[model samples]
Target chain A: MACVVLSLVGISAAPAAEMVRIPAGDYAPPLRAAGEPERVAVAAFLLDERPVTNADFLRFVTAQPKWRRSRIAPVFTDEAYLQHWAGDLELGPLAPPCAPVVRVSWFAARAYARWAGKRLATTAEWELAAAAGFTRADGKNDPELKHAVQQWIAWPVPAILPDAKRARPDFNGVRGLHGLVWEWVEDFSTAMVTGESRGDSGLDRDLFCGAGAVGSRDPGDYAAFMRLALRSSLTARHTTTSLGFRCARDVPEDSSP
Target chain B: MKATAWLCTVLFAAAAMAAPPPMEDCCKEAPPAGPVSARSIYQLDATFCSDTGQCLPLAALRGRPVVLAMFFASCGYACPRLVTDMQAIRGRLPAELRDRAAYVLVSFDPDRDTPAALADYRRQRALDGAWMLLRADSGAVAELAALLGVKYRREPSGNFAHSNLITILNPEGEIVHRREGLGGGLDEAAQAVVAVGKGK
Candidate 1:
């Protein structure tokens, strides 16, 4: 284990992971209607350089045995939580050490994030960070970025994902925001992009049923639309092979030390 | 104002100390007779402040069947109907059975729904007799909402758009039934409460 312990009084540190600082900024998200300001303001914070890897999660489960697949409360996770793993403490042979961890429920992800002295990124923070491409901080309008995201979305989820290192980093030096796995944002359930039960707006009520339906401000942002749709369908306990997560930390106050 | 300041003083003081015990340990003085079921909502470790300014562990209600709803005080639509739905369900129950069951409303807008706000809401609605409105920090609200499968979003107009869900939990804290949308569905929800009360 290459875990380093740096206990600076005011600085938060992680073991065996690289995190980069993301500066504060505002970006209009593409998921809304054409003219509405889908602008989300994200504050300065530290983000994991890559998604939490299988190896990283293995270490976490080892340390916090309460989250072991066998021991976890069903209220916190579904039956498939970490079912890909061979056992409570062992990974399947197909899971690579550096591949992003999959089959983690929101509760497990939240716990792991807490154990790492971090928290799951909020939706605004994640989107703001992900809006960056290799060259531009806000790539929502970059055709190349849009094309790359769409291409990744179209690819079938492989039985085993490749190393997180294989996914290219964005302008903010964060990796695996796309082209690896669908990340679990902290406020995913708040997406609320579904049909209104009271309002009869002639939407596809069948698909929107049992979801929080708020019309998108940018209907043309198909990628964000897909993300919101998927998010709206999920409960916190639901886990899937394509879903994983990364951790983030609030920038420590100067006086905290 | 004095009451608000006093409540804030008490709340912050409690927060400065250790987190209130997890739901399981909250009842250590008189622990639940058996192991908490894995599916019980009590598995979530959250602390909430009641409308009357009583700080409570979520598990404190473990022995009583609860009808819980998530709502905000300032909601212009849906929430008033949601509260009425709860009342309608309560009215459907036999008077004796109603006293045994607890009705809880947790706020989605904690920033605005202080204990005072909740108390005001309770008074305006004339809610009493095993009924309470509660507020917690934003993080706890999110976790409770997640456990209940309630979806909510804050809109630019300062109003909230959310799923209207009323959940019925057994005395052991397991969710027995849920009603979705505003108004109606009282019979099923009431029967759930009655059944859980008998089961306990």
Candidate 2:
């Protein structure tokens, strides 16, 4: 048994996954319902090198002083989260300013986008950009962003849906989508259906934490159920240490989704 | 000629004194929030202007007792109960003391709220004449809100993120007491009002 196990273990490391970068262009979700695929307009921007920092969001909050958090209407402070994210050094410069901001509500994120004079990227736009997949030769943040994205934009071949768990957003190209914080999508209602009451069923399940039925086997699936589900898990009604945002710009009329 | 000039001056001074500042029951000289900090007045400034442009400064409501609570006019369930509580409190007041106190309802929904909307909101509540529905253009709202230590936020579902706190202030602008949640009835709030008013 030992000899057999050792021989099986002799299998070499899996080769690095291929990355195919699709060019800057309009794209559609690889998975569609039985009928027509809804084509969303994809505007393009250079992705944030990483999830936005505390300083990035603080800039948004300070500029829109109207958005200053109020304790009475404290929507975003989950006792569980504050205990997890806050550091012990409250009054000092030792605090890490660039650590990702947490505990932001959806409204605040939208307000931040508006303040930035940009909008949150829609799921379709995000998927199209994410899909043209990338594989990193190495794993550094900046180079990873560039290299993985370059591989993603170059993806030429298609794989089956089940294989997509490892595939980048559009996997037709070698683009990378993993290892970053979850991105917010614009199609918020896909998680909700019409006529849902607070407890009846669907997205309005609970005020504090409800499931968004935008269910997906993989994050790459930007279907209505999956999109709705992503919106569901969020608790952003106030400033939390966990919440943050990124801005998406509109492509000139000449651009695509 | 000197006597005539002195008489004219006295008459002009009398007219100036007669034209008092706007709030009659209010305007007692009260100090800023001092050493005796109380919990009921947790979130203080009441600067949200109602649609009619009232700064709705709760601190301005010094001296004459105040029964202050927060409410959103659009609320489907909890709001009417809040009104009923205030009305019941008003019902308990002796007519003379009733005339001595004020009630202000500040809306957190500034985007859709207007002065006309506030007037309609007041009318719907059927609150007694002493209650004033107010709004402000963000700045005064923050000021008055901070004074009262009132906290609130807008939720993803378009409702407000708020706690239920009702405060009763003395004529001296001190928060004598507070009750948390919709459970505080008009009787409870009015009781606090009467207690503080009688002390003054």
Best by DockQ: 1
Q: Rate residue A76 of model 1 by lDDT.
A: 94
Candidate 1 docks with a DockQ of 0.26
Tens digits of lDDT, candidate 1, B69-107: 989998777788888889899899988778778899999
Which RMSD does model 2 reach against the true structure?
Answer: 16.7
Off by over 4 Å in 2: A1-52, A57-97, A102-257, B1-47, B55-78, B93-97, B107-113, B121-129, B135-187, B191-200
Candidate 1: residue B180 Cα off by (Å): 0.9
Top TM-score hit: 1
Model 1 lDDT on a 0 to 1 scale = 0.79
Q: Which DockQ values do the candidates obtain, in the order shown? A: 0.26, 0.05
lDDT of all the models against the reference? 0.79, 0.49
Q: How many steric overlaps does candidate 1 have?
A: 7
lDDT by residue (tens digit), candidate 1, A68-87 = 99999999999998888889
